[model samples]
Target: MARTGEFLMALDEGMLAYFREMADEMVARFGIPRAEAVARINRAYAGQEFEPYPDLMCHELPEYWAYGLYFKPNAGRLPDDDPDTDLSAWEVRPAPPAGSPAWTLEA
Candidate 1:
């Protein structure tokens, strides 16, 4: 895969997990049919060259509503020697470490 093909998620795994959970909730509420919903999403992605952020819209369902985020990757990733080698074009905020110090008493 090309360098730009690499996906550096803006939301860390933790945040993404939460987002996915919420999205799932939305889907449950929308009650979108499996086949229809998948088709709808696929339609939106047709011919998408680059990652395009699509505004999530909901389809009213019997019991609930279903929503989805649409993103399409660019037609081609950046070249190997591109200036964005380090993804400098994108602003990256480091996630805080996921551990804490513990104190223990020793004799």
Candidate 2:
């Protein structure tokens, strides 16, 4: 993996736990297996750019990430099937300022 990839993969316990919770929620809500739920989450996030760890954890909710923030629902799924879900309204929160505490990690 590249250095950027390595850095992204180096999530702290809190971030790991957050993703675990997201997968678990996906399973419970969507009635999908754990592996599939995780795959979906990965697919949703693939090629997307954002901060990890404290930065993301601080500003984003797991449900937003798990459900509609990045995931485009063309696969016939629960939340996707729901006619009332306004996916168009979902948006990623603004990123923190460059020199803020959210970017204070040491190299």
Candidate 3:
């Protein structure tokens, strides 16, 4: 298996951008360090044989990947699974830490 850096460098442009955004989202929303976020994302995809990840993915918001929803075996959230579904508008926002606001309005 390729190292994480090697695997990341081998990604096509679209997948590279997608994973970059996904890792950034993980850092922002989960309060993780950027290196850790990237490592986590790398861990998920580094050894995988999936080709053209961007073309295969449903183009769900990066937040979905940050929340680990994309790692679920039966996420059932693909475009073909439900063309009418809009994951961005779904009510599944990540819960804030204890005593924090329930949600923040993203401008």
Candidate 4:
């Protein structure tokens, strides 16, 4: 297997070549200049992660999508398979010692 750098380089080269070929084809077919052709190639690339976030307010998404990322399923849901679906499974047995709960906030 190629090292991480080599793999990344290969991917970069492939994508760049694809853009270059598309730009060249568009220029030849449409009589577009190099700058405009490159701009077209770049504009085609603008999407998903590449596009600037327009309006990404957290509350804009569905309730589940908004909350699911910031918080876990049930606060007391334990991963252990002790055959119990109870909050007792997550009972905080010990109190904080010298230093304490730095910060706590929900919503």
lDDT of 3 by residue, 1-107 (tens): 22234234356666767767877776665476565566555555555554565556636777766766323323554322244655454433323343322112221
Q: Rank the candidates by lDDT, best first.
A: 3, 2, 4, 1
- Superior by lDDT: candidate 1 or candidate 4: 4
Tens digits of lDDT, candidate 1, 1-107? 11121122233344333333443543454353333333332233323332222223212221122222211223433213233454334332221122311101110
The Cα local distance difference test for each model comes to 0.29, 0.49, 0.52, 0.32
For residues 3-102, write the lDDT of model 2, one tens digit per residue: 1221224345566666667767666654655655555545444445444565545475666556652344445331443557765644432333445332
Between candidates 1 and 2, name the one with more favorable lDDT. Answer: 2
Judge candidate 3 against the unseen true structure and give its global Cα lDDT, from 0 to 1: 0.52
For all predictions, the C-alpha RMSD in Å is 19.8, 12.2, 9.8, 22.6
Candidate 3 TM-score, true structure as reference = 0.52
Expressed as tens digits, the lDDT of each residue in 37-64 for candidate 4 is 4443333233322112222322232222
How many steric clashes between backbone atoms does each model show? 14, 0, 0, 0
> Residue 106 in model 2: shift from native, Å?
36
Q: Candidate 1 versus the native: TM-score?
A: 0.25
Model 3: residue 98 alpha-carbon error in angstroms: 27
lDDT measured at residue 95 in model 1 versus the true structure, 0 to 100: 19
